[model samples]
Target chain A: MAKVAAELKYSAEHEWISTDGSGPSVVGVSAVAAEALGDIVYVDLPEVGSTVTAGETCGEIESTKSVSDLYSPVTGEVTEINDGAVGDPALINSDPYGAGWLFKVTVESEGPLLSAQEYAEVNGGEL
Target chain B: MTENYTALYEEHKKLGASFTDFGGWQMPLKYSSELAEHHAVRKAAGLFDLSHMGEVWVTGLEAGALLDYALVGKLSAIADGKAKYSLICNADGGVIDDLIVYRFGDEKYLVVPNAGNAPTVAVALAERAVAFNAKVEDASAITSLIAVQGPKAEAILLKLTAEAQHALVTDLKYYAFNELTVAGHDVILARTGYTGEDGFELFVPNDGAASLWASVAEAGAEFGIVPCGLASRDSLRLEAGMPLYGNELSLERSPFDAGLGGVVALKSKEGDFVGRAALEAVKEAGSQRKLVGLKGLGRRAGRGHYPVLKDGAVVGEVTSGQPSPTLGYPVAMAYVDVEHAELGTALDIDLRGKAEPFEVVALPFYKRQK
Candidate 1:
């Protein structure tokens, strides 16, 4: 089972967002998503200045076995993208919550969100 | 419908493997990182549970004659311990399934088929054997297959065998099998693998599968052997430029279309085999679309069913494509018009409505040092 961070909020599509309500919210794929996708080889992220809509696909993730769409959990302007993850997608599998963060977004609004415990219950993850 | 489980299913669960429903069986897709597993097979060795593959025993005085009549290859010409790669085709020359036929004795042979097509192949063989003095029995349910593949495969096996049988491991020829006791279990060891590596596949009864797997794992510990699953296996075979049954060879395509016409054995065997006339006509007409290897000029890969284009016009379709883990680029196999099948020809694959540049290259993007 994947680990779920208690301080984060999750979406049904498996993206995680920081709940600190700071300047910019940190966002990434949850550990569950990374584990489900075996070996991620390539990641296509939205541009830094691009705007993303909640509950919409914002990028693509390609693994050895298959390809999957990366859905956005919040509607916002992309502030920055994780170049390290873009260069080596395996980092997402190794450290999904910290260095493997996909992007930082200046959130204007968020879609339906679940707490860490809720997410762990829904996705069979461990805290 | 209820799915089937292999004898090693519990072992896979213990290793925290991810499962996928393949060919009506719940099989392991990978244990952890498939990339790591792929590298392990290339650098050291990897253990694989292949019990899902179907095994059919064809025995009798006319076993040789039956296979020669049923399959495309000249099975009777092969030696006692040798194996032949052949295809069972329909009357229209379309391949039903590709098989590996192993001759155990003058009157005994084993036919191994892919998991999904096992029942169909057994039924087809039984139907074709009515006129011949032979019997077909499906033994898939009672058998288990395990493989150790890589450059270190032989070294790992030598650690498992006793000094008396060390010669058997070292002297085994490729595409050949010998009866040997491995890990205190009787197994039919064959130097054959789907990955483009010098490897061995062991056939044993279902009851001994778990212990044999554990013993092999323990013996291969020093050689860095990881338990591999179907994910790495797919990439490995693709990099080796091997044709998968459902992907490269299919009921809609003939052997000539896949560049495997040499296995048809039309001239050497005088006995008329199944699909002889249709295949003869196909041989005379020549294939319209020829299979060719494509190397991506860009980072994006062209996946299956993606349209291949020549100067904005659709010319063919990609059967299988992936990022080659060993070669560090994207490789694919596609069937294109004969004019565009020549090596070094430039083309574009319509990858998700975007054209990506590709060059036609030779099959088998990777090969072992030998």
Candidate 2:
């Protein structure tokens, strides 16, 4: 089972949002998503200042197994992208929630998200 | 539907292996991280459960003659206790399966085929042997295969057998096999493997799989042996430039197209084998497509069925590809137009609509130190 942060919110597509309720929200694929994706080889992130829509493809994560689209969980203008994770995608597998964060966005609109418990249930207790 | 399991299925399950349906058999995809398992095989040692591969026995006074007619290679000429990689082809020259023929005795041989194509190869062999004095038998159900591959493979394998077998195992050259008793059970230990490393493949009865695996695992523990799965097996083979049956080889392409034309023994063989006429014609008229190795420039690895582009036009397709764990770069085997298959030819692979540049390099991206 993957450890889920209680304070973080998760999307159905497996992206997790850091819920500090502050200026910008950090987003990255959850630990459950990282384990499922295996060893991530490459990460493509949205450019800073680009607008993203919730539940839409904004970037991509390529693993040894296959390529997957990274869906944006909240609609907002991208403020910052993780250059470290982009250069070393394996960080997403090692520290999915911390240093592996994909991008940060200034809040504009949000969609329905799940609590840690709800997200755990959705993944069949895998998260 | 319930899928088939190998004799070591329960053991793999206990080891926390993730299962995948391969060739109708539920086999382990990985026991741990694929990258770790791959490195273990290259650096220390890795054990494999290869029971899913097919083993067919041919026995009779004319067994050698029968196989010569059934396969593309001249099997009868290979010395006893030696193995040769060959291809089973159809009358139309299309490859049915790539197999290894082991001449165990004067009147007996063991044919090992890919798991999925075992039944097909067995049936083809039986059909081809009808006129000869040989009997083909599908012994896959009662047999299991285990491989210990890496730099430390030989050292670990030598400890399991008696001192008498030690000399034979030490003197055993690559592609040679020795029949001996392992833990009081009969086994055929061969010096061969799909990985680009020194390894030994042990063929034993199904009942002996668990014991053999346990003993080998225990003996290999001091050498840091890890039980590997199919995922690493695939990446290792890809780096070795080996063609998988469904991916790089199929009924649609002949051995010539897959760069395996050397396996076709046209000059040495006396009688005409199946597909001889068509393969001869294929040799006379060069194959339209050729298999080549592609070295990916960036991190984006080209996957199977991805288009190989030249000058922004599709000229071929990748058959097997992945990020090489040892080489630290992506590599792929692709079938491209003959004109663009030369070494150092620049090519582009459209990976999900994004083009990644790569260069044609020599096959067997990694070769073991002799």
Candidate 3:
């Protein structure tokens, strides 16, 4: 019963991206990743001017049991991060695709991104 | 690694719970989401599978006297239908294991300890009992524990007993237990839990676990009782300011250093127990490092083993750190030097090399809004 957005492009690591001609598309953890990570406690978000590359570490996310790295789906300059999401990480559990988006990137390169369905094929089976 | 499964494992799978390997067992982490389940216990009720914890029965003519020499607390005062928490100590006065002693009768007792430390505790008790006359038996295989926690836990338990055509267990106190017939089997119902919520822990035979879980879940449905896992349980206990065995208190650190001196009975009417001399010495003098609560000023949480510094000098190490569920802010427990351990002492935790501001706060970050 988990939702996989058709329009969103996802990474094998579970980060999702939506490309736009304008600068800075929002990035967030996919639905599969949110369920896997359980209740998110704290999120380490990149600053406004920080530069991130494809497959690079953008920030970090903490659950009750462990801390995890947030991989960047595409390379670009960090534009803005979600302060509200950082305060209440539970918002990410509720809506990992909408206002719970992690950070916005300038999209420097057109990197390879998988569809939501593809990500589910890898992680959504037994778990 | 051993891959043991609980009787509730398949039941949890049917409920769509997230499972994780904990201490070599496939345990439920959460049913829906950890945050949601965490709040459910804070606001409503949550059930947990605590079968992984081990239980040992110590019963003999000298059971009372043997426990008196093996553990720190005086156990002779424990009457039937009562439970007391104490630390099993090493000869050097270090804590071997923290356990709850259940006084089944005047001459019998049951000690519940962590699963990982169960074997060690049994061996130590038996070795110490060589000077006395007692019998220590590991009864973990026959007992299965299920804890129902939260505000409405008692109501749900009452309904389950009535609906199952069984007699309800009344007159149970916060740390007391009694026998009851539920689901056509006699079960030991104890009014104790790790979560800071009001709840009960039921010990039933392994064969009746599946049906009893279903029966209780059905009864708890009306009260919005949610099935929680180890994840919510960990966060809830941390918010209550309780220390985990391996994380906060260990064999290396005495109970006196962990801010749990209130439980130590140094002024016993009789002579001392195993760790009496060293504990008395520490009590007269002071502990070098004291456990204190730290509140991070920002969203970035300090992970475990992060250095706690004062004026650019490493003065302490964080034993446990997590963004608290109730406070909605980063909270952690650390042992700092006596000079910097006082409440409200301003400190900084090094988050991977960057200094994050924090201040010492009192324990039990969140209490029931009395």
The sequence of per-residue lDDT tens digits that candidate 2 reaches over residues B29-78 is: 88878888999999999999999999999999999999999999999999
Q: Which of the predicted structures, 1 or 2, would earn the higher TM-score when compared with the native?
A: 1
TM-score of chain A of each: 0.97, 0.95, 0.90
> What is candidate 3's DockQ?
0.61
lDDT of 3 by residue, B169-287 (tens): 55678889888876565788888988888888988878888888888788888888889988889889888888888888888888889987877777772755788888887778888
lDDT of 1 at A106: 93
lDDT of 1 by residue, B85-168 (tens): 999999999999999999998899999999999999999999999999999999999999999999999999999899999999
Candidate 3 lDDT, tens digit per residue, A3-54?
A: 5676778887788898756768889998777777777877888889898888
Per-chain TM-score, chain A, candidate 3: 0.90
Error of 2 at B208 (Å): 1.4
Better of 1 and 3 by lDDT: 1
Error of 3 at A29 (Å): 2.0
**CA lDDT scores, all candidates in order:** 0.93, 0.92, 0.83
Clash pairs (backbone) in predicted model 3: none
- Model 2 chain A poorest 10 in a row by lDDT: A1-10
Candidate 3 has a TM-score of: 0.91
Best by DockQ: 1
User: TM-scores across all candidates?
Assistant: 0.98, 0.97, 0.91
